[model samples]
Target: MSASTKPIGSARGPAGPLESRPVEDSGRRGLTDRVYEEIKALVMDHGIEPGARVGIESLARRLEVSPTPVREALARLESDGLVTKRSQAGYRATELLSVEGLVDLFDMRRLLEPRAAALAAVHATDEQLDHLETTVEGMRSHPVTGERYLVYRRFAALDQEFHDTLAAASGRPLLAQAVQRLHTHLHMFRLNTAPGDALTTVDEHDRVLRAVLRRNPDRAAEAMEQHLSGSWERHIAVMDGNPAKK
Candidate 1:
C-alpha cells in the first residue's frame, strides 16, 4: 500500500465526492456515527495507510463536517485500536503487525484457543453448536477468489464469529474477553489484501465444529490446533510475499 497521506475527500467515486454523501439524520449523534463509519472504512480499507498521520482538520474538510465529529470519531477509533494518539503530534493509523508481533499473536492464540475448544466440547450448549454449524455453512457460500479484502470481508467476519462463539461456549467469560480483545480477524485481514485459503479455512472450521458437536474434547482440541497451525502458515506465507496455497 502507498505510504502517501492524501486527503480522503479529494477522491471522487461513482456517486460523487465522499463528503457529498448525505447523513441519515440531523441529530448530532447520528452525524458522529456516520463520520465514525466513514473514517473507520477509510482506516480498514487502507485509504489511510498504516502508520500515516491523520489530520483532523483535513478529514473534517473532506467529510464536509465540523472538527468536533471528526475528533469524536478518532477517539472511538482509538478504542478500537485502529489509530493511536501522540503526545503532541496527532493521530496516526496503527502500524501493520511486524513478524515478531505475528509470532506473539499466534502464541497467544495457541495458548488460549485450543483450550477453549476443548472446554467448548464439554460445555457448549445446543444453541451454540447450532450457531457454529450455521456460521460454517454461511462461510461456505462466500467463496473468496482474489486478494481484495472487500471481496472476502464477510468470510472474515464469520471466521471471527466462529472462534468467538467457541470461546464463549467454553463458559469462561475472561477467556472470551481476552480472545475478543486480540481482534485477531481484523488484524489478520488488515495484514495484507490476500484472502488466504478460504476453502481450506472453511474445511478447517468444519473439522473443529464437527469435533465440538460430537462433544469430543481431545478431538476438538486437536482440530483447533491444526486449524491455527494452518492459519499461521497461510499468514506467514502472505507476509513473505508468497500466495498462500489454497
Candidate 2:
C-alpha cells in the first residue's frame, strides 16, 4: 500500500490471452501519454502555479495511478522547457522570464529575425510565397475571441509555421535551424497571457508577408523590426501592469 512499492495495474492478476496482451500493453502506453497530456494541461492552464515544485507521489495519488507514468510525463515536460529539474530538486514548473531576461531574448530575436525577413524577401520562391499566404489566411480566420485558449493555441501554431516557413524561405538552412532552436513559440505560450496581443500579431504578420511578397527586402526588414519591437513592448506592458498574471 506504500507509494514507492505501488504497482501501476498489477492487481489485474494474471495476463489475459496472448492476443489480448497487446491491447493491455497498448493501454499501458496510452496511460503514460495521457498522464503526459494531463500534466502539460495543468502547467499550460496554470492549474499548477508557476515555479512550484511538482510532487510526483502526490500527483500520482491524485490521478489514481503509479508514480512511473508521472515520472515519465515529467521527463517529457522537462525536455519541452515547461518543467525544470535540478540536481536533487526533482521538477518544478519553469519560471516566467524576468523583464530583463525578456529584453535580452527580444534583443537576440531582433538581431536575427529582421535579417531573415530581408533574405526571405530576396529569395522566397512563388511556391513559398503561396504557402506563406496560406498561413496568413489561417491566422486571420482565427479571431482572438470566444474560446480564447483554443484560438490562442491554433494561432500560435500558425504563427510558428509562418515564421519557420519564412526563415527557410531565406535559403539559409543554418538560419532556419537557429531560429527553430530558440523555441520562441513554446516560451511565449508559457507566458499565459490573454489573447489581446494575438490580434495585433495578425496585423504585424500581414505587414511582413506583404513586404516579402512585394520583393522589398528593406520593407520586409522594417516590418519585421516593427513586429519584434511591438511584441516586446506588449509583453513588457503585460508583465508590468499585472505582476501576478504570470
Candidate 3:
C-alpha cells in the first residue's frame, strides 16, 4: 500500500494539549528541573546536533550541572524524541527530518490547519491580535541579534510558538493541545535555514493576523495554511542535513 504524504494540517490550531505552564516543584527533589529544562533547551537550542553522540560527563561540565541532573535530563529527552539512545554510544541527537516522513506530515496539515485558522479568526480577541502583531514586529526588528542566533538552534520552537499563539487566541484548549502534540513530531524534520526563512515566515503570519483582525475566518485560515505550505516547500532544502552553518 502507498503511504500518505499529508502535511498533517491536522495541526490547524493547537488542538490537543497546551504545554503545561512551567510547573513549580513544591519539594526539594523538584529542583532537578533546573538541570532538566536547561539541558532540554540546550538540546533544542542545538547544543547537541541530531545523531551526534553525546558524552554525559562533557555535557554536565558544559551546563555547569552535576552529572546526575545531566544524565537525568537526557533520560527525559530520550522520552521526548529529541534524542536517541545508541546501544554502543550513550546517546545522539535525532535526525531533524526525513523526506518521506515530512511528505506525509505536510499532507496532514493540508487537512487540519486551514480550518483552525478560520476558527481562530472568528474567536480570537483584541488582545490576541495585539500580541500577534507584537510578535511579528519583534521578529522583524531583531532579525539578526545574538537572540536571533539563539533562534537558529530552536527555529522549530519559535515556529511552534508563532503558530501556537494564534491557536491559543482561539481560546479553545483542546485545539491547542492537539496541535502542540502534532508539532512535537514535526520538529524532527528540522533542517538549518537562512534568516530569510524566518522573516518570510513572519510576513505570512502578518497576513493571517490581518485577516483575523478583520474577523474573516476563511481568509485567515487560508493565509495561514498557504504560508506554512510555502514554507515547507521553500526550506525543505534545509533538512538536507548538511553540516550546520555557523
Candidate closest to the true structure, highest lDDT: 1
Q: TM-scores, in order shown?
A: 0.84, 0.76, 0.68
- Model 2 clash pairs? none
Residue 44 lDDT in candidate 1: 67
Global CA lDDT computed for model 3: 0.61
Tens-digit lDDT track of model 1 for 112-202:
9999999999999999999999999999988665434446668878989999999999999999989878888878877754544788999
Clash counts for all predictions? 0, 0, 37
- The Cα local distance difference test for each model comes to 0.82, 0.75, 0.61
Per-residue alpha-carbon lDDT of candidate 3 for residues 1-246, written as tens digits (9 for 90 to 100): 101111111212221111323334455356466656655544444445556676788656544546776678778777767777878777776766566666766776666667778888888878877877777776565553222223343444456666777778777788776666566323542343445566777788789889988999989888978887786776566655443421
Residue 155 in model 1: shift from native, Å? 2.0
Which residues of candidate 2, in runs, are more than 4 Å off?
1-35, 56-73, 146-151, 192-194
Best by TM-score: 1
Candidate 1, which ten residues in sequence have the lowest lDDT sum? 8-17
Compared with the true structure, model 1 gives a TM-score of 0.84
Give the C-alpha miss distance for residue 18 in model 1, angstroms: 3.1
